[model samples]
Target: MSMQLNRKYITIVFTVAIIAFPIIIGFFMLNKVVDPEEIMITKTEVSPELITIQGGFGDSISKYHGYNISHHDHSLFIQIKGSKFPIRGDKDFNISFTNTYGDIAEIYLVGQDNAKRKIWPQP
Candidate 1:
């Protein structure tokens, strides 16, 4: 009779562990799902024409200037007046431009990487 009770107790313990193991794993998986900081923006696209910039100069320049913008992974490609320029970023960039006589030009730059800010002053 003692042997039968010992076997029953062992079976009950084993069954409870089998059920509880998945529950414990699911609890950890739920934490992983709820974390938003783990999410990343794999790709981003911005149209130069669609962007809004403050100040009178930015508004006037955007209204008259034209640009072609493209981004792939960490690299940026910009084309204007049959010339292309490439830039790479470990984070993000805010780009703007101005055209003088449709020949002479300037590119404004604002960028951030790992929370460090940089601005390439208007030229």
Candidate 2:
């Protein structure tokens, strides 16, 4: 009978550990989800005929490949290029495009790892 009681205690502990393991791991993993090379928008300007965006990466410019911008359905997507052989030096971008994102509502800055952050219209 004591052996059965011990088994019950062991089963309970095992089940508790099984349920708690992912919660513990997920808590640790949440901290790592933020990218170290994420981009940050420092300034933005919107005019009647032009829209200007300026930002830079968290790391050195060499760590990145390049940048691109796309306008889609009232939103702007800034895509960061990933590089295997990166260039050396520091650089920031100031790009202007025709104010064509009619009724622009959102702007996204996409990292080299494909992670995205909304930069405009402060959320």
Measured by lDDT, the strongest candidate is 2
TM-score for each model: 0.30, 0.54
> TM-score of predicted model 1?
0.30
* Candidate 1 structure quality by residue, lDDT tens digits, 42-75: 2222343333222211111111122244444433
lDDT of 2 by residue, 1-123 (tens): 999999999999999999999777754433222242465668877666888877665665323334577788888877754322233323465667788666788887765476777777776
For every model shown, the clashing-pair count is: 0, 0
Q: All candidates: CA RMSD in angstroms?
A: 18.4, 11.5
Distance from true location, Cα of 82 in model 1, Å:
46
* Candidate 1 ranges with C-alpha deviation above 4 Å: 33-38, 42-123
> How well does candidate 1 score on lDDT at residue 70?
40
